[model samples]
Target: MILSVALSASLALTGSPAHAATKPVTFQGFTIQVPIQWHAKKEGVNLRVITGVCSPQAAECQSFLLGGPQAVKYASEGGPYRPDQPYHPSSGVTECVPVKKYNSGQATRVRTSKAVFGAGQRARFTEWKVSCDGSELNVASYTQRVWYVKAKKVIVVDHWKTPGLGGILAKAVWS
Candidate 1:
């Protein structure tokens, strides 16, 4: 009985083996565990988590972004990004492809659902698809996922499709 209790305590403290390689990342009043290799950087009023390869010239590299009310208010081409609205991170032509002269068109919402974060905190989750335009039309495409907590005015934007990120966010803890 004593051994079982001790093991239970250990499990509670360290989590499962799958989480052994993760580290807690805090933003605003929320925290989530992400792979230890992921690097977090502060960008303006937002926090960006670098998950994969990135380009120095790309406006948005392969990573995710965490933002507060201020960042959300001006997230889209200096406009607001409401939960019910479409996502438009930038205006005019923006670089979607790392290669030179490749640009991206508008982003359209493809899927949306209710998501949970930070100890059952509810959020609006959405996926947007954008097409890359270069020498040929619709050369390539990418998906951008977003989770918005309206009451808290917090948002998580992921464009790189980082594995297990959604599950990590679902298990977040709020402070």
Candidate 2:
């Protein structure tokens, strides 16, 4: 019985993660609806799904961050920061995930995000980036995200920033 119980516990952890929460919380000015797993902190939140992690697949993470809420440069020597030339460290990134680019045109729609159609209001796969004052990005960021409504809930999930995978928290969704 003990062995069986241990196996079950392991399955719960290793098995497929539970779908995210589907509630919208209004902070500052913007309204964001996300899953429960994507817990909201004082700043932003964190969620995970079939996206990139800190282990690998970080190359694709760059294309997601269009910019930041602030008027700062991204891949250059300036305000927030710039990519390290050699042996880049992953300590800078604070929060990294996809965001909802509501006003994005069709041109960026194809590359910036992914759509998940559903019965009711479809959850838009948006990129979520960290910011200083809902303007300038602080650290790392995510490339993209998958947003969808499951069981009448809007949830957003993606890869957790890890080593090698790097941090990507720029051009986030905000008010």
Best by lDDT: 1
Q: How do the residues 89-163 of candidate 1 rate in per-residue lDDT, one tens digit apiece?
A: 566566674443467765678999998886859989998887666357647677778998888889898877778
Give the alpha-carbon lDDT of every model: 0.79, 0.31
**Over 4 Å off in model 2, which ranges?**
1-21, 43-175
Off by over 4 Å in 1: 1-17, 56-59, 97-100
Candidate 2 local Cα displacement, residue 100, angstroms: 26
Between which residue pairs do clashes occur in model 1?
Answer: none
Worst 10 residues of 1 by lDDT: 92-101
Winning model by TM-score: 1
Report the poorest 10 consecutive residues by lDDT, candidate 2.
102-111
- Model 2, residue 71: C-alpha shift (Å): 8.2
lDDT by residue for model 2 (21-119), tens: 345544323344444333333312322222222334232232212122221122122332222121111334333233333111111222234343322
